[model samples]
Target: MAASQKPDNVAAVMKVFAILEGLAAQPSIGLSELSQRSLTSKSTAYRFLQTMKELGYVSQEEESEKYALTFKLFELGGAALEHVELIPLANVEMRKLSEQTHEAIHLGALDEDSQHIVYLHKYDSQFNLCMNSRVGRRSPVYSTSMGKTLLAWMDDNRAQEILAKTHFIARTRYTLTSAQQVLDELPGIRQEGVAEDREEAELGVRCLSVPVFDRFGQAIAALSLSFPVVRYEEQKRDEYMALLFDAGKRISSGLGFYDYPFSRS
Candidate 1:
């Protein structure tokens, strides 16, 4: 067997990982020094470096013949960190909403591939009859308040691209059945810093949502409150909106975004 593939194939894996660690320890590295640090043959180190470069994890300085780590690793790490940070921050606010309103509370994020808002965390209403949803369940973007809130904060073209891919199945008579219908409402929703689903996704359920922002001030998720039509009071709309906005602001602030656009109640 080739030396690079020796030691039950673990040595080659360890060698490449060592090379990555060595590359990370400095801005850039030459093949000879990287090989020396990783304790691998120059040939093996070069092969692994070439593979990492092709995979977009490493870049080479043409003039100096040195290899450097790329932003790709940072991008992956940032995505992981965003999810990790979002849930705990959201949980704190979600618990508060649950106690205050005794209504279904949800934290949702966009799933572009599915063209839906995925419930990331949720608190069931205290009542026996309430909105039916759970964590990991997906809902149509064009009809759900959390979905609309997420899209409203996104770039117009990107939001349109996602809308174009959506199947737009009408889950209820009130559901908006076209992309243009949903698109037209996004501007107003964004302007108000909130969105609503008035019996759109379900017959008896109404929902209100506010955007959750990240450190970059980008809306990365949405927080929502759900009420049954029989239990909902028109006069309490403002009260529910206030609760959602308060939770959203605290969650966003915890995520490093201090300027949550809406006024507090």
Candidate 2:
């Protein structure tokens, strides 16, 4: 490709994706709405839509004269996801977090049957006094940061159902010892897009976690950073949250979720 033609090619590619995103955002839309949403002229948008329709990636409702995406994207996405192994994909992001924070990093998933967070992968902290945990260790959902994160992003009824079964054992003085207490805190966790274990799961250990989503936008896993209270700096809470959220977003994206439901800023 010639350097002089690159800008036009890039702009054309952007326009196509923008139109595709616009269509994906709603059930269907007329050309005018799509053109405005995509920041392209009607003629350009229509031309792109026609090309996509011919390619079987888009469909046009004859009665409404509206454009919408076909299941082609879903088919493509499903094929891609089929080849992706979750733990290895997560390890790339987890390793980066482990290096950056030098803390115990964990990847956990909800074990719904047991109502616990199962550690899928972990990186032990470089410090000798780090959190002692291993892959496959199960921790109560009511007391751990990763567990709370998984619950926070879940549907309220489903979350409540899981909470109802929880024994709510007080692992420490900080633990929330009731289902209602955990339920009350879930909204705040969702709003903040993070969860905290303030020595609740274990005395003298503090952990922060963020949810990791899949293509269906379900919170399938959580990424967490753990530190002993002696090593955890209160002032660096924001920095720690940022790192965890970043890793969560990256891992979620790898799982085919483009929209990470959290404010980066």
lDDT on C-alpha atoms for all candidate structures = 0.90, 0.87
TM-score: which candidate is best?
1
TM of each candidate vs. truth: 0.77, 0.68
Task: Please tell me which predicted candidate would have the highest lDDT against the true structure.
Answer: 1
Candidate 2 Cα outliers beyond 4 Å, as residue runs? 1-84, 112-114
Candidate 2, residue 191: CA error in Å? 0.7
Residue 132 displacement (Å), model 2: 0.9
lDDT digits (tens) for residues 27-89 of candidate 2: 989999999999999999989999999999999898999988999999879644643467888
Q: What lDDT score goes with residue 156 in model 2?
A: 92
For candidate 1, give the lDDT.
0.90
